[model samples]
Target: MPELNRRALLIGGAALPTATSLTPASANAPNNDEAFWREIAAEYDVTREIVQLENGNWGATPRPVQADYFEKLARVNRDTSYYSRRGMGRDLMAVRDRLAEALGVPSDEIAFTRNATEAMKTLIGGYNRLTPGDAVLYADLDYDSMQDCMKRMALRERAEVVRIALPEPATKASLIAAYAEAFARYPRLRLVLLTHVSHRTGLALPVREIAALAREKGIDVIVDAAHSWRQLDFSLPDLDCDFVGLNGHKWLAAPLGVGIVHIRKSALSKIDHDLATAPDGPDQIGERVHTGTLNAAAFLTVPAALAFEARIGLDRKSQRLRALRDRWVVRARSIAGVQVLTPDEPGLYGAITAFRIAGKTSMRDNGAIARQLLERHRIFTVARDGVERGACIRVTPNLFNTMAEMDLLAEALTELGV
Candidate 1:
């Protein structure tokens, strides 16, 4: 579609800028806050045909990153040997270092993975300690992939898979108590997986408290920051967890295939997952290099994403997202038979929200509702799975998303009479 428009303009007028017009002179013009984000959004090329509210799944990368990613691919294709031998590994790693610096963690403490799933599997799959009756505790709301991995370990090692429900209208204390209760149920609990921000309902859990409590019980914690990285503000040192994993493309606005893992230096020796060795060699911590070749462009463009964030600032972005979310909540809760499953507590939720109609259908039926919303209203959303609640519609918005989009969603959802 961008190409079609580009061609149309060429036929009658000056062609649309192919991101080449974004010179320093242009970027330096006036106050950058609004213009910066607007420029980034303009690059996304999201069609007017649908309102995308499911960024918890994945977000289309920004134009700068997309262009950079394609450039890296072209570079590789341009000269395979020169790119592979020298230009690929170390040069690309400078970008990784920059990513680590942005996260406030040491570069050596960071490693790239294919996605959050790979990071989770690498961090826990070779945990190196699991006795019979040993346990891995998790909430009912943890992502199905992580839970599935835990259950697989349960089947193979005779380990206990302790599950507990998160308290609704969650508070830091309530979330702490929830994990405590689950820990109390299993005497030999050895690990606890906490989703820093739940994918289904977009609840940003209190990771610091949860990790501190788990530490008291001598349990290892691996925080899934899949949504937390961009959806909420987080600092690694403050959380004090053993490991953290995140998806770069979903919320971070980086090119796809750039995921992150941070293993506390002390804990690296204890973790023995198989990944490619970084050029520095295996004796070093954060020496992880994925075996397969990866693109340097998307990984490099992380700096562009961060620069864009610096322009908008996390606080202002959070304000915009929360305001959008609160608007949806007001519209959703007003409808009869609608029950918000996620907490309405401002701190507990970011840009994500979910609600079910009373006795209308289970959360599993959410996919049906989501499909209907899309087919009928051109609103794109996702239905969550693998929970006691039947199904739930998950909504997330990026910086590009506007209140107008939310209004469209609200009108369409209210029309469902749910």
Candidate 2:
């Protein structure tokens, strides 16, 4: 591992500035749009050994953010006592406030966690009001760990857990109707778990509509927005939910081990304070998750990542990713034995999409396909299970990915008869 020295990087003009100072070149300039995005991609030092198409799992920190992370880590390691006692607390809170502002939410409503999994676990496990016979609902597309947490909550509360498999070739109406049926079937449903975007198939759910329906049915929803927050062109409020779990590393391009938990002001009472910090009171969102000591460097580097994203603008990033996905998906669909898991409708997906070879429903089969893609084509992808229909190869392209790379993948899939 390399340690960064702020003096060297800053003096060399390679260091990125603060969010207030960094501004992207005007998009109005003609014929330079692609050039500008390529400039953004240049900030990363990815290798050519393999083309990475599994960025949905964890987005590697770009050069600028990694520099900041290293600098912060070195600083913390050098002056551990002083920074921990006299400096870290204030800086951490400042990061929180900046992040909250960027998300268009209240600062007090958000708290930092290790990742979306821990944030979600804190939310699901600490929600203590369920009683015997109360029901909770979750879909097959929900993250596996979150579904397990819901099941544990059900067990602890002596409640019934309702699990449904989302319909294939899902449409906006069909997605919403599935939740509606779940609510109707289980009238006692008190809490529902919704994934803003499905990790298995890259299907972006209609969270706002589903949240509203849950509210109408007297159900409080805990949203797993780990994949959607930065990948999509929206904010927390857009989902119309009181609780959400987000990942900074996935699309915000932050260092790993960074995630967020948001609890609305009015909904604070629904979650029980974490046992480790129970005495701190339930009003503060931080009390909901008692993470003792974490990698302070990762959280400290968040501002740089946010500044980079802010410079590019979320909407533009989203559009670029959608175009990349469309580039490959549109071509891949022409091949035989190919099934695109994500719907072809607008606003239902972004860069993430999955594909399957006909009748390949087993994990081993999907894994073999992913291996072949990597070994034969030098294209890296991952196999995802838990989709009711079958396992699929998830393809995620980041900002650094080029259309040529997607063309290579299309060629590979076509060659494989998929």
Q: Write the per-residue lDDT of candidate 1 for residues 171-248, one digit (tens) a residue.
A: 767877888777777769998899988887788788888788778888889888888886777668867887888888
lDDT tens readout by residue for model 2, 307-401:
87776778888988898899899999999988898998887999999999998989999999999998887789999999988898999999877
Q: TM-score per candidate, in order?
A: 0.87, 0.92
lDDT of each: 0.73, 0.86
Best by lDDT: 2
Residue 302 in candidate 1, Cα distance off native in Å: 2.2
Best by TM-score: 2
- Score residue 328 of candidate 1 by CA lDDT: 78
Clashes of 1: 6
